[model samples]
Each structure stands twice: as C-alpha cells, then as structure tokens.
Target: MGMTIALDAMGGDRAPGIVVDGAALALRERPDLRFLLIGDRARIEPLLVRHRRLSAAVELVHTSEAVAADAKPSLALRQGRQSSMRLAIDAVKDGRAAAAVSAGNTGALMAMSKFVLKTLPGIDRPAIAAVVPARRRPVVMLDLGANVDCTAQHLFEFAVMGEAYARAALGVDRPSVGLLNVGTEDIKGHEAVRDAAALIRDSGLGIDYRGFVEGTDIPEGTVDVVVTDGFTGNVALKVAEGAVRLMASSLGDAFRASLRAKLGYLFVSPALRALRQRFDPRLYNGAMFVGLAGIVVKSHGGTDAIGFSHAIGSAVRLVEEGTNDRITAEMRKIASPGPQLVAASS
Candidate 1:
C-alpha cells in the first residue's frame, strides 16, 4: 500500500542477481517500502531465497521474454512486450507500483516507457536527469540522453523540470538555472541555445534563469541546475566521470613517488579517500527520466549494489513528493506553442 518499486529483474549486465541483491538491501533498510520483482520467477525466486530476509518484502511477477543489452530498443519492445522491463512499466500504469526502476538497455527502457505511460499532457518528450554534487547543494542536470538533439524550447523545458526536481529534493526555493554552452555570452551559442536563453530569461517561469554557464562551472555550486540537450549532457556526464578517475589515479602515483610523499599519503589517505568518494561520479549514478507520467528511474547499466540502491531510493523520494502532479503543472504552462497543433486538433 505504501510506495512500491517495480524493478525490472532481468536488467543491466548482471540481471536478476545484482538487482535482487539491491532490492534485498532496500527492503531490509526501509520499513515502509515494498518491491515487485518482474522477470522469470524461476530465476528471481531462487535469488530472493538466498537473501532470506527479503522474502516477505518482495513479490515476483513472471516475465518470460527479455530484451538483451545491445538489442535495438524499438525492435526489442515490439518483439518482447512480455519482457521484464515492459512488465515493470505496466505495473506503474496499472496502479500496482508507485514507481519503476530499470538498468536495462537505455533505448529499450525509454521506448517502452514512452509507449506504456505515454508523455504527460504538456510534455512533448521526456529527458533524463542526474543530481551532481557541488561545493554546496547538489546540482540537477538534464537531459542525460533523453533526446539526442533538443530545441532551445526543449532545453527550456528541461530547466523547468530540473527546477521542479531540485525544489523537491534540495528544498531549493527558486533554484537558479544555467544553460550549458561553450561560453556565457548571450550571442555565443547556436541559434537554439540563444533563443532558449532569451525565452527562459523572459518567461518568468518561477525559476531563476541565470543566463549561461559552461562545463567548467558545473561543479562550482554557483548554480543549482544546468540545462542542456542529451548529446552535450551525456558527453558532460562522461567527462566528469573520466576526470575524477584520472585525478584519483594521479594522486595515488604522486603519493608513492618518494618516502616523504608516502608518509604524507599515510597521514592524508583517509581524507583523500573521503574526498574521492564525495566527488565520485559512480556515487551519483541513478537518474530519473524527468517529465514522464510516473516515477521511472534508470540506473547505470554497469552498477554494483551500492550504486543500484541510489536509483531505488530516488524512486521512493520522487513517488512520495508527487512528482507527477508537479510535472503536469509545469508542462501545462509551456505546452508546445503552435497554431498547427491547435488547428490539427480542431
């Protein structure tokens, strides 16, 4: 009866095993939450048995088919409606689960979600959102591969969605937003961003549109949200990850360079590890496909139990906060303006 997360049991690279393990942890840790594991019952039940404590908190819904990791999403969906991903999505639509979580093929998950839940009344397409840790409050970033290319309008829409999310998660009233661009100048970007910036600046959408912010400023915490298209957003996400890894590796090498440095490392190793974990991109792996009709979180495909738990926890928070109602309200104000849409409907 409380918020339930319907997990795609046969998802990600690890499938039923790793996902089940995370579900076990979440159930043991959170008393109010429940789980519906959607996949082949034979495979999932045995896995759940191994974690006997989770037996009471989890239910299995059998789904025979599976959409493989690298298969074409649309094609997979058409041929594999009985797969775990589709079944899990259906649970949300059928009012059985408050949310759904999957680490399956990204395109397949999105495609099935778009079909099963459809878009919200005012949203044209949904975007993926990630919360990035900053020097201060975490920054909400989107569209993390929701749409490969996006219009300025789409970016603007993402801004609204990001603000709504930040407000709920960070308790940020009137969160300041920055458009991701090569430069901060108003005239510095392609026509899309320039036009989007003008619209966000003037629209008075209850979110603070703080002009443009570049990639370098993402971790600065000067801004609460960064808005961009999926192409740039995905690249930024990977770059931040790679940078962190390289920095950590370099630090290890430097620490072992000399006896004095080794002594220093012994003194500072704890602090350094803490800092590394704090900035680790892997720590912020789960992201919501924002602007959807229901709460759907997509996790990193290659994730361990720790990373997977983040996605489950995010789904719980999003569900409790009435994400759907807030999303619907935001989209209504900016419902794709066009006489053609109105005329077509008429």
Candidate 2:
C-alpha cells in the first residue's frame, strides 16, 4: 500500500547490476517501498539474489529489448514498444505504480513518456526539472533540456510547475520564483523573459514572483525556483558542473604544487572531504519530467548505485507528497479567469 516505483533495469550504462544494487539500497532505507523491475530476468535475477531484502520487495517483468544509448528518439519510439524503459513508464500510466525512474537515453525516455503518459491538461510541453545546490539550500530549476525554445507562456507555466515542485519536494512553504535572465532589472531581458515576468506578476499564481535573476543569482540563492528556456538552462547547468570540476582539479594541483601544500592538505583533508560531499551531484541525481500526467524521474546514466539510490528516493518523495495532484490543481487555478493569485508574499 506504500508507494511503488517502476524501474527500467536495463536503462543505465551499467544496467542490471547498478539497478539491482540501487534498489537494494533504497529498500534498506524504506522497507515499505516496492518496485516493479522491468528488464531481462537472466541479468537481473542473479544480482537481486545477492540482496535478500530487495529480492522480497520487487516484482520483475522481463523484457528482451532495451533502448540503445545512441538511438534517436524517433527510432527508439518506433522500436522500443516492448523495451524495459517503455514498460516501466507503462506501469505508471496503468496505475500499477506511483512513479517511474530511468537512467536511459534522455530523448528516448522523453519521447516514450510523452507518447504513453501524454501531457497534463493545459500543459503544452513537458519540462525537465531538477534540484541544484544554492547558497542556502537546493533551488528547483526547470526546462533543463526538454524544450530548447520556450515561449513566454511556456516559461510562465514552468513557474507554476516549479513552484509546486519546490513546495512538494524541497519543503519550501512559500518559494520565491525568478525568471532567469541577463540582468535582474525589468528592462534588461528580451521580450520573452520580460513578458513572462509581467504574466507571472499580474496573473497572481500565489508564488512569490521575483521579476528577474542573473546567472550569479543561481548560486547566490536569489530565488527558490529559476525558470528559463531549455537552451539557456542546459548551458547553465553544464557550465556550473564544469566550474565544480575545475575547482576540484585546481585544488588538487595546488596541493601537489609544493611539499608544504601537500602537508597542509593532510590537516585539511577532513574539511575538504566534507565540502566535496556537500557538492556531490549524487545527492541530487533525479531529474523530474514535469508537466506529464504521471511522475517520471530521469537519473544520470553514468552514476553509481549510490546515485541511483538517491534517484529512487526522489521518486518516493514525489509520490508521498502527491506532487502531481499539486501541479494539476495549480494548473487549473492558472487556467481560470480573473487576476487570481495565491497568498505567498513576494
């Protein structure tokens, strides 16, 4: 009776091994959580046998085909009808599972999910949303790589969805929403962002609308939800990742540059490790495909079992919080007439 998550056992780079290990890790944390593992039984069964706790918690549905990492989205859609990824999503659509999680090809997963689950009412396109570390805590960012060119209306809808997700997943009671732009000033952004800001401000969706935010604002925690087109969002996401990697590399170089520095590192090793854990992407592995009729979390394909476990935990949290219902209710409110807005202060 607790939340059930459907997993595509053959979706990730490591496939059944990491999938089974991740499920075991998740099961150890949440005993009541159940899983419907869809993949080749030959590969998965052996792995599951090693974890007795996970063996009892899963219901396997074997599938012979799997979407290839390099396959085009269209190709995947045509040939992946019986694939593990598709079947896992099917479980969510069929009401047999509360959510679906995959570490498969992004395009294939998005295509199959849209085709099977369809979009929610009033949502023209589904956006990929993820939580990123911020100054205070993690901020919810949407349109990570879903639609490259989003209209003003699409950005507005993203704000509504992101705000709801922040409340549900991040436990932020009243999250401030910011439109990602070149500058925070009202006159600085292009027509799309400027227009979206006006819509968010006047429409009164109840979320705290902080007009505009620059790239620096992201890590500064200027707002709780940062909304932008997929192109910009994706680029920003990658740049942030590269920056983290560069810092780590530079730190390593500095430590090895001098004998004194190497000795200094010994004293600071514990603090450095703590800092690394704070910024580890594994802590935020799941990226939710928002605007869908059902919940679907996309994990990083190359992540290890620990990262995959975090992804499963994210799916469970979304289900337990009724995130989809909150999105639907907010969408309905935004669709209705009047200068209506909810009651959170800006």
TM-score, candidate 1, is 0.92
lDDT digits (tens) for residues 229-276 of candidate 2: 999999999999999899899989999999999999999999999998
| lDDT for each candidate structure | 0.83, 0.91
Global local distance difference test of model 2: 0.91
Root-mean-square deviation of every model? 3.6, 3.4
TM per candidate: 0.92, 0.96
Q: Write the per-residue lDDT of candidate 1 for residues 268-340, one digit (tens) a residue.
A: 9888879878876556767888888877899888887777877887788777777778877766766664566
Separately for all candidates shown, the number of backbone clashes (residues 3 or more apart, or on different chains) is 0, 2
Displacement of residue 264 (Cα, Å) in model 1 is 3.1
